[model samples]
Target: MTLLAPGSAQVVAGNRRVGMMALRIAGAVVLLVAVAALVGLLWRPFAFWAAFNPTLLGVLRWTLIGLAVGWAFLFMDAWRLGQPLSLQQNQRLAVVGINGVLCLSVAGALIFGAHVVGVQRDFTIAMSSDGAASAAEDGRYNVLLVGGDAGKGRWGLRTDSMTVASIDEETGRTVLISLPRNMTNFPFAEGSVMDKAWPQGYNCGYPDCELNSVNTWVGENRELFKGVEDPGMNATISAVEGITGLKINYWAMVNLEGFKGLVDAVGGVRLNVRQPIPVGLPNEKTFHYIDPGTRTLNGHDTLWFARAREGSDDYSRMARQKCVMNAMLHQVSPKTMLTNFTEIASASSDMVSTNVPSSEFGRFIDLALKARGQKVSTVSLVPPAVDTSDPDIDKIQEMIQKGIDQAEGTAKAAPKKKKPAGQSGMTGGSLGSLSEGYVANQADDLGAAC
Candidate 1:
């Protein structure tokens, strides 16, 4: 009776006053919880906001601890009210056993939930402790994604792979604008440090200073950006902003070597392998290939599948990387997140360093969830579209703008690309040849492109 009504046992026995107070408190708690849930259901952003709020999380943790103690006490009180001393020895033993199980199970479940909530708080703090909250820039949030490597000779990390995930603030429509690292002779944003340093463009010479080298250059000349928190990233962002003509809201730097841990954490990602993908560098005798077909790839193989360049060029590899990004976004559902909470949090916190603040954590998560339901689009600055050796800056900006405009319904895409029914020259796990350009690299609907 007490388990169901919280105070019924006491009310029917020797503690009517205590029972009335307990029942009143329980009723109030139920009303409060019901109202909160109803509001959350009606306004989902509020729910996400509440879930990610550190202050609320701390309160929730302590509240659960309190509830566990109080609930166990109530169960024990109910058992005492049953007058177990008056029962036979066997009956008493059975009652005690049943009561103990109820106390433990109910309290244990609440405690565990509280622990999970704490983990989320910790993960958010570690991942989102940089700078101030940024609002949507001209109805969108432009985030720069940099995949880099830190080696012995390099200053910090080389910004080898750069992509801008431009998301619509209202509708969550996203367009991925990818810039090739080899792109040269590009100008920086007007009046920016890079632009001031190299007024004409980032053209030290015919082969000098490719896009990725900007980070290394910034690292070497830290005195130029004396007060900046991260000079390398700031420089790279300036370059990307210059290249894409998009106002970047924030940025995330991902270590490629650490990416496998995230894939493993989510139990790997499922992808349609168009061809056999090499797992090691060409020089290694131990190199093997991930075979063709639709399947889930473990961490090591998934990393190789995305980064492999054994038989492929940089452009083809970029398309494969885009496919990997799309797969991970769609495959890792909220259910997967809940089930593998700790592992994913642990892996992600270690893998990514972002300037996205804690205040906007809920908003970005909500946006990501919204993004999953929409058709993703992409545009890349690779060969045939623009010459990387001496890219036409005006053309590159126009391509990015067109992609974003098409995604926003402000402009029409060139043509509806039919799902590739086995393209003629698909190899190296990408949907098209390097010379022709991969379908996934520049698509109106990335799902069909992949």
Candidate 2:
């Protein structure tokens, strides 16, 4: 998925206006020629000039009048676009505001092109976990949630991890596919088989080619693809798209740096840490330490919390990412965003980039509004005994595929009644009473990742 910058709209709209102007100029030239011919023909007044008609003068008169009217309207449109900035409006703010609206309009048209070419930035985020999107008849939409560290130098942050989220809207079911960065042969673009895609060395030059290195990969590849066709982030999108065998409807590439600002703007977030975890800078010796369990973290600490992986393995960190996601969602109230608009926007200036069209924001808003009162379930892939040692990578993929299929079926049947206490977690969880077959063989397959 590729997200063109908002300024791209100005370029497109400018080109379109230029094209229209050229056409109008051509039309004017044609009219002038006709007028010249008519004047010559009418010069011989003795030869029944106005006998059959108004000597062609009337037609020419009307054409010029119409042209004037059209130009007047075009001028008015330009004036409207150039509406004077308010006295209180800073020049920068006015420029950004006008261009933002224009960019959104252009992005709307870009949606069609994106669909055809498999490029997009905005993704439909299922706010509620009943994952209704996955159950939709339109085929479950699987999205790759990539936290790209594009603005490391500009904003001083790096993408922590990559997680795949699939939603079946029809059945309100969702499954999170978490891929450990170091899980060798985690599937890149080079080979047909997963094993064939693994890097020769795990660290792979400190990130660019490594499975787990976050900072190196984004920065290096972005530079590498600067001149290549469909290069840079699109390569990452393609690799993930191939891995999941699902069209990436939308993608939101969040900048890690802005996350802290966003969190701070939202007045910080509260999380119940299960246990104290050490937090610190990354190094081979004496790393930082962070104690966990029920703590309200500030912006910087929040970054440390989410990015820390010194002591625990990737799986635990995946859970931490989910926790951060949940916290952000819980606090992502319109009031919060509105209050911190400037701060949030400033933080996001270079921190995030996405290909999602601004148009789809409404669709997601509508869906969220509908599911506002429903229950949400969050699941990870690591629980219920995952067989990571299995040599057959296809088996794991197929298992996930099957679970997705069954989950879709279940979501479509009916909303499962809220189970009583002690029934929410995986085991003995109510299958929503819609159908038993959907849950029987599938629950086991879903493992703890459902």
Candidate 3:
């Protein structure tokens, strides 16, 4: 009877009303849950609604907790109703042990799931509490991604990798504008504080005026930017705005060392190595090489892969960094995120510092989801396209505008002329041409180019 109907034994033992009530309630709950699961599977909006709604998340967290506690109680009550005292010793022990194990397993899984949800909630709170900046007048969000290196003996933090991710407000289409650290003679936005300081341009009275050096310069001359909270960052923003001809919305700085922790948290990232990359500094007498091939790299090795310059130049490193960024964006699946939720949240909070407020997280998250289905375009202001030693601001601005137009589908890209049969499409070098591995100075389809 117990096997045929969970509460039937109790019914036969004279608890007829209670057994009937339990059976009805359990059947109704099972039916409701199955229907809901079916609906969630058939209706995509149902899942998205929960993801975008904070209140829904809260309700889910509590619901899981309640269900776990209530289900455990039901299992305990079932064990008691089994009347172990009246049964033989061996049968009684088996029934009690089975009920206890089932109770613990179900309750434990639900409780663990609830804990994970709580951790995600805390992460959301930390990310969203701050207010987001208003969109630019052009209706785009121009976010500066700065890769800060704070290695020992380095004077202050140096922003070696800089890129402006300009996102469309409605469609979420994006254009990545990469700037060479060695770019010189770039102008700041007109009439801005930085422009006032270097009215002519960000040109030190010397032959070498590196763009990356601007961070160190601003750090040394903080008094010049008296009211600025982060002089170096502000100065860099000014330069980037001037170079890209895009208004800045917000900035996010990632500590390169802390970046390793994030990769590790997500079980590392995979990449296809085109060549053998050396790690460690030759000057320090430390040499380690990452053999070429497709494989998953741990935190330490991934960091070096993104920042290595031993057998490669800065341009090659920049291209590699973009590849890593792409891999992280596309490869980190939802299941991986859920499984490593706590570790990822902890690592992300520690590694990243951004001016983007918490209020904008949901909106951005939605946008990111939208972007996942679209192609990502890139334009780098590097050699052959523009002289890094003395960049032409007008040409750079034109290139940026053109890339934006191309990405938005408002303007068709110029057709690429066919290369000679015997020659490589990209420029001939160790890393090949900028467009060889989709490492283009400007490309409509980054993936195709690679």
Candidate 4:
């Protein structure tokens, strides 16, 4: 009887209706699970439905919770129907223990799944952006990566590092375009509010107007961008779009100070250090330096490694920041992510604010997985190529287009030339003695260049 029906013992004991109802419920659940599995096998539809619909996700979470409770109750009832009281003590104990273990295992997994769903729900709610999802334009999705800092006593926020990562829609090949923070006399996009406000460019008459200063300026005069969700961000985007000659799809701002916590959460990032880097201001009584070599850096040290300016200029710092970004892209593995998922999520929610909507996470995740296997190229609008102080906008756009073409395989990259030893290959300008192997502004392969 027990072999034919799960609740047959109860039926044999004359609770016929109850036993039949339990069996029906169990059969229905198994059928439902099988159907769900089949649906999951056709993953595209499932992924689209799951990724875009918050209500469906919530319903699924509750369904799992309900199934877990119902299954536990059914298992316990089946055990009760077995008539353990009439069995020998050892046999009864064995049956009871087996049922208990099975119940606990299934319930534990379901509860953990429910917890993960709750975490994802909270994350989506907290981080969902105002921007709408859109397709890649002209075979690329150009995203602005802004490194913002709102340090102690600093008014508002300053975006000191700005890079545009243009990713190929099909191949996942990426080219990072790094703009100098101090670049001046750059145009904002025509018809943009920023352009209307300062038709002559982001020039403030004197030499104080710079690319980085645009954020602060926008913040001071927010009324100029009456309907903008983020005035500073919009202004910066206009400047970047004008400079790069690429349509800006979305932007993500990372708080540099909060970045420390994220690095720690990922355990740490491994970097191949070419030279010793100062960690703090030279004027301070005591300062520490990160010894040169291949080493993993903690959050605090990594921040300094990326932003230290005591013995380095902003250009050198930019080069280091690129190295750091490259290392993070390459070294942090899926296993590391799963191991520290909660910490990483918590830290990221605090660290990053982006206009890339939550619904698009799946798409980006797929792109990131694709990117892992591809070589990343870089082009910077610094020195030799374009003057940071007074840039030639047309020439700058041409350089950027050249890089894009090279990445797309429409044009081959120029051959590398060897530089004489003991001489700085590129002009470091006021920034003295860049780190060894620091290839400024241009590289076919960023990892190898650093």
Candidate 5:
């Protein structure tokens, strides 16, 4: 046998080594994807138990389940890559496989965290803070859930859906009020384009602003609501306080993207449709017409439900919106969560932004636990209470007085049996009485700051 030259042998060996390294790197990538997927699926289970009592065992169990699902998908991908196809085709197949695992893991994790954070933050604020607890004690806690819709070239944020949620701690009841974006209100904030609402010229020293003007002014000054005027958060919060006749202790503003991510994170929520919604929105937007059934929805479908403005206008959309929320809640409960952790977690990364800190998570959990066996109710601030045609100024004042009376009344009432121990420190002094709820009488027509 002829012996090869030393130089040639070395060059061949080097080529072999390079090929081996490339193969090893590719294998590692696939392995990592599988591991990540497994971790994702088990996130919910891990988080739920973690809330009860976070332990090494819980994490390990969740990780193991995620890995099992991930490995199955990995093998499936590898097989697809091995099929007879062009180099690009094989590459695409591997990517799809990797993405599948990645998405699954992210979904599971996000669902876990959303509930973990949402419940924890909301409840803790309601329980520990005297301000928040008082609102609940007073038979109402108005939660302004604002949805932002910012279009190109627009100077302000458009209110998509303004929902005020009231929780009555005494009865463990919940009432939701939806405000129309176009509803007119007085200029609560001073120096606004509309000034009739503040005829007193901000003399009350309410930050030198009137209630109606507050939203726009705050939007102009606060970096948060960059381009919007009236119905700005401050304005909205104030308006809500005016209408409900109760003090608002907390606010959660969610934008379109965050809403979509939240819906998609938990595999897909199932919603019931009573009527056929028309497809094809204006500007070439393709919308979904949800059929009456137990229909499952991903992010896109959930958005369609939220954005549906045809057929029944706002009322129909409101019904659909509630359905979507209910569906999402059902999908994200503890047991289902354990399996979808990764997807849920990843989706949440895009959906929610709030001021509630992570440290207060445990308190939120306590509230959730307390609310579990309780009843929830819904209320809408539509038609009779206030109308779209009413002048912005007069309507806003009515809302404010309503909030004050409600706040004061709840503060003065004798502590009920259901009042949580040591949870009674809302505002200082007597909150006053709701002797008259929503007084449209001539005497109280003038809106005043609390």
Candidate 6:
């Protein structure tokens, strides 16, 4: 009776008040869990908050432990109330065994739950950002994503890939704005430290002032960004904001080399192989290739698929990187995340350095979930349409605005940029060559492009 209803034995033995109180607690727990589950499904942001909030998780952990201990005590009290000494030897032994089994099973389940919650708490703490949260700019969150080298230096040093995920705050509709690292003669955000240095734009007689060199420039000219902890990242943000005409809400820098570990943690990501993608560096002797097919690729091959520039231009590599991003969004499931969260979190911590505060996790998580079902849009400032050596900032900003408006259904897409003559062949494991501009670069529907 105690095992079945938690306090029915006490009720039967005339400890009615105590029994009622115990039953109420048990009922409250069940009710709370059920209500939480329902609310979580209806409103995902609540679920995110519950899962990511360290203080709440800590409270939940202690609550589970308390429930386990309290329930065990009630079971023991019920066992005592049974007056086993007056019963048959076999009956006494059976009663004692049942109570022991019930206590262990119930307590064990709660303890396990507590452990899972603790693991999640630790993960949030590990990834916690020191950055202050910012309000969405013009009803959207424009996040700068930088892919750089994995080394001992600053996070923004040598940003090989720079993409901005401008997300709608309400719909989670996204427009990926990619900037070529080699872009030159671009302006910095007005009134920014970099802007003060070169009021006209980031143009020097020498080549050290390219888009990717912002980090190095900041390091050399520390006097410009006084009191800033991550001057390079701030300067980089300024550059992106200036180029895209989108105010950056936050920035995250990921080490390109550490991407392999993140991929492996999710078991692997599925991607349709368009062509034979190279798997090793150009100088590698035992060169291998990821055979063509729709396949699930492990960490190493996937990394190379996105990174390889062998027989491919940087533009093609950028297209493939967007494909990798799309694949990860669709393939990595919520169930897979729950099961392998620790490994995934560890890998992410190693690679990604983000200024997204822990408090905003719920909002971002909800948006990501919403985005999974929507068509992602892309706007790569790449060839044919853009001349990276000296990009047209005014035209690029117009392109960006059109992309955002198209994604939100407020405007029609501009006519596709005409490809150059004889640019029909597929290169860089994507749908089109650099001259033609890969479909993934400027697509209304990213899935078809990939």
lDDT of 5 by residue, 1-450 (tens): 001121122233334453344445446656866775676456533344344332333454455455444434443444343452655876877766765665466445644555555543343333232222222534544556766653342212555676665545443234445555555433333433223344433234433343333455555556644454323554566555554545666666666655676666666776654456554565665644667555676777667755765644553455455445434533467655546655555555444434433433343434444444433233334444445445344554455444434433432322323333554321111111112111111111111101
Q: Give the alpha carbon lDDT tens digit for every residue of 147-217 in model 3.
A: 88855534235777899988888878878889988888889977777899888788774434678888778
Error of 4 at 63 (Å): 1.6
**What does candidate 2's lDDT look like per residue over 11-72, in tens digits?**
34444554356455646656877886687566633222322123243454454445444433
Score candidate 2 by lDDT: 0.47
The TM-score values for the models, in the order shown, are 0.92, 0.50, 0.80, 0.87, 0.50, 0.90
Worst 10 residues of 3 by lDDT: 426-435
Q: Which 10 residues in a row give candidate 5 its minimum summed lDDT?
A: 441-450
For candidate 3, the TM-score is: 0.80
Best candidate, lDDT:
6
Task: Indicate the worst ten consecutive residues by lDDT in candidate 2.
Answer: 119-128
Q: Give candidate 4 misplaced runs (Cα > 4 Å).
A: 1-52, 87-96, 150-156, 205-207, 280-287, 424-440
Give candidate 6's total backbone clashes.
0
Q: Give me candidate 1's TM-score against the actual structure.
A: 0.92
Of 1 and 2, the candidate ranking higher by lDDT: 1
- State residue 150's C-alpha deviation in candidate 6, in Å: 2.2
Instruction: Give Cα-based local distance difference scores for all models.
Output: 0.85, 0.47, 0.74, 0.78, 0.46, 0.88
Steric clash pairs (candidate 4): none
How do all the candidates rank in terms of lDDT, highest first?
Answer: 6, 1, 4, 3, 2, 5
Worst 10 residues of 4 by lDDT: 427-436
Error of 2 at 396 (Å): 2.6
lDDT string, candidate 6, 65-144, tens digits: 99889889888898889888999999999988998998899989988888888878877877778678999988899999
How far in Å is the alpha carbon of 313 misplaced in model 5? Answer: 1.4
lDDT for model 6 comes to 0.88
Better of 3 and 6 by TM-score: 6
- The residue ranges of model 2 lying beyond 4 angstroms of the native Cα positions read 1-137, 150-159, 169-174, 186-230, 281-293, 368-391, 402-450
Name the lDDT of candidate 1: 0.85
